[model samples]
Target: MKLSGLKSVENAHDDSIWACAWVPATENRPALLLTGSLDESVRLWRADGLEPFLPSPSTGHCLGVVSVAAHPSGAVAASASLDSFVRVFDVDSNATIGTLEAPPSEVWGMQFDPKGAMLAVAGGSSGAVKLWDTSTFELLATLPVTPPNQQDQQPPPRPASKGSTPGGKFALSVAWSADGRRLACGSMDGTIAVFDVARGKLLHQLDGHFMPVRSLVYSPMDSRVLFSASDDAHVHIYDAEGKSLVGAMAGHASWVLSVDASPDGGAVATGSSDRTVKLWDIKMRAAVQTMGTHGDPVWGVAFRPPGGAGVRAGRLASVSDDRSISLYDYS
Candidate 1:
């Protein structure tokens, strides 16, 4: 229920680290940490020591790597950038598996389905979430995000001018439910779109924040529970199926950039522009501890996924704009 700093990697990247994920262990090796940064490279590190797994960082991404997702099998992973391309590569060999792109639509947040059969990508400006087949790397479907009906807006207010518009719903983040039956995506205008994957239908919209939502993740223990990080400087927990804002937590002094649910489902961790990472106790709905070790905005936080040989204790990681990566023990 608390975090203790274990290892710190100074200057882990030439620029800011925008994303991080733990690649589940395969028969050959233990779980490894994967990071993407503004330096236009993706790097792998040993989870225990933060040592670079490869001789050099993997390169080729342009416009800065912004998001990264590892396959459930841990054999392959994908990294997306502002350049509108998602490069799928082998985890061990780092060889290119396939390149995916939905022309004219930029890629943002991404997550592989629980079964590792599909990849869900937040399609910026396209106003949709794109699903791709993991085996063929071919486009599977696009679920468009529709603006809610005027009456759907609580207390229906008058429209504002162009200058005051909150911008269109450009999908900024995506997360798949535990069962892979549901998927939720966050947008530029602060709306969360929930979809039925099998039917490819937009179920409903979850409303609360009025600013851009940058990150989202489903609770590992509950399919209906969802958490989102937004520019409004708050983390909102929602019941995705019921379309209700179940709870809200506010403590971050600036925009919350990233969020992750702990393996046990008892707590969550968030990174903020306030240059700190906080651990929130889910039952209490409050921040139990704050770690302010980064000098710049903390951009990415990840809970090491459960399950690896003899890996029982919990581990957490945070990457920041200060060009550092820090690991913590959660117990």
Candidate 2:
């Protein structure tokens, strides 16, 4: 797979663009892109011409938007702020549907289940993953973080020790299994925990990264495969169910902030503080293509989902601290 520059929107956001997701195409429209920024706003954009949709989506977020998750139906999506406000809004109308708030538990990463029936949020410093019913927009449960191998109920070693720390790491990123039976969250301390969604139990921890893991994605084709990007400047691929780190790829000189796997599951893309975007072939466990030399750190990267009528060409997007968004063609 290769990535070719398609378009770059300079100053895409007034502040840094920290999160992004692709809203699936509907009958009257092609797929649209959603971006959240530290500017306290979330904007919608059309891939064609890389132009912004008129009317400036929404601007009520208090602090800054940190995470965004799109519902499976493409009718609605949610955005979370540092102030712990999760806003679920209409995609086309920009009308607020539901607002979820829970104090004492800050939001970090969030993702909707495969069926869009549930939403899972990584709670920062709260030591639990918060689940909300999407339809009702009500808090359902808080699953505590506990390492599967906690001897005598003691937490693992501190981070920075090459992941000797077992559990209770600060949750930084979250990803749901393709089947929606399992959920995985990466922590600031570089530990990734897999949880049994059905049983509401801690499954295990996958160890490898020694720094904060900011982004994670499960392969669309395989529920067992997970890809992670971390401050360690490396991307690790793991079998979340097997509880083993199967592959590691390193190329960035600085922290890797975001990672997303291709729809085909043949490759994974990463954005790094080194101001670069890279594509790594999963089977080879090596970076085959590199793009970007932005002036500041790349904060987020996302692959367009494989749906929507006539959406054949592959697309990739990256947002950076430089306040720019870059689009690429992956084929």
| Over 4 Å off, model 1 | 147-166
Alpha carbon deviation, residue 66, candidate 2 (Å): 0.9
lDDT of 2 by residue, 278-319 (tens): 999999999998896567888889999887777889999888
lDDT of 1 by residue, 233-308 (tens): 9999999988999999999998888999998899999999899999999999999999988999998999999887
Give the residue spans of candidate 2 off by over 4 A.
Answer: 148-168
Say which candidate scores most in lDDT. 1
Between which residue pairs do clashes occur in model 2?
Answer: 156-166, 157-165
Q: Residue 28 deviation, candidate 1, in Å? A: 1.0
lDDT of 2: 0.84
How does each model score on TM-score? 0.94, 0.93
